[model samples]
Target: MTPDAILALYEWVIGACFRCGDANLFVTPIDAVVTPRGERYPLAACGGCVLDMEEERRRFAERKGEKYHPGRLGRPPA
Candidate 1:
């Protein structure tokens, strides 16, 4: 992907921290997928945000009276 697109996604993830109400958190890159096309990207998450996400998910699930599952993260195969 282009640098601009990658940066926008990075900024998006950062902004999501606020949406999750875990704005104090940030991601730490641990690994990244290499698309079959050969583009690489980072896979990371902030502990605080993760916790917040989990809590939100829990609330949503309870509100709906069932567990919620967020699908895997990554781009489609090339």
Candidate 2:
């Protein structure tokens, strides 16, 4: 799903962030996912949510302390 991030969608800049469910002032980075059947649904994720996700990911990585790294494309490096 790729969201077409826009500051204003039809002159509206307030919505719920998919991650935190807060009043979003910046209608940016909205995730727009398209279903296989050609249906589109906007997600709830603001910039703050993206940061939060990144932080959570970093913490998770720290916990695992992985040494092996996968290929850039997730496949084994040739």
Candidate 3:
């Protein structure tokens, strides 16, 4: 199976966001991130959390004087 499909399956098993612990039928499956201790963990986010994350990134970009190009950050509408 493809990586995305695998991630989707993993999300299906968990059924909630690692960060916010919000459960949903569909969540954005994030790629695994490595921590300072060398542990890897995959994450998922509900729609609301995803939008909030994007907004935070945009604000950070503005503060850094970098252009925040909003493109394809979230799931496409059904």
Candidate 4:
């Protein structure tokens, strides 16, 4: 994947962690993901809290502006 794609993935993961409300979560920030890709991927999950998609969306909407709706990103009416 391109650098941008990787960084996007990391951002999504961090957002997921934040939404989970797991204070112990530790993830490589977006800035650090700029490094050259090595033999392994640079993604990790919160050991304490289980990641939930619905919860993430709810939390994201609360913090981000109302324009942050994910459904709008889906395919539009044909």
Best by TM-score: 3
lDDT of 2 by residue, 1-78 (tens): 122232122223567776677874653444577899999877655555554554565566678894422111112334
Descending-TM-score candidate ranking: 3, 2, 1, 4
Q: Model 2: which residue pairs collide?
A: 3-32, 18-44, 18-45
State the displacement of the C-alpha of residue 63, model 3, in Å, after optimal TM-score superposition.
Answer: 0.3
Which segments of candidate 2 are over 4 A away from where they belong? 1-15, 66-78
Q: Using lDDT, give the best candidate's number.
A: 3
Compare candidates 1 and 2 on TM-score and give the better one: 2
- Candidate 3 lDDT tens digits, 1-78: 333433343333435776688775567675567899999887777655656666776798899998764423434522
List the global CA lDDT of all models: 0.47, 0.48, 0.59, 0.37
Task: Give candidate 3's TM-score.
Answer: 0.57
> Cα lDDT for residue 74, model 3?
38
Select the stronger candidate by lDDT from 3 and 4. 3
Q: Global lDDT for candidate 4?
A: 0.37
When 2 and 3 are scored with TM-score, the better candidate is 3
- Model 2 TM-score (2 dp): 0.43
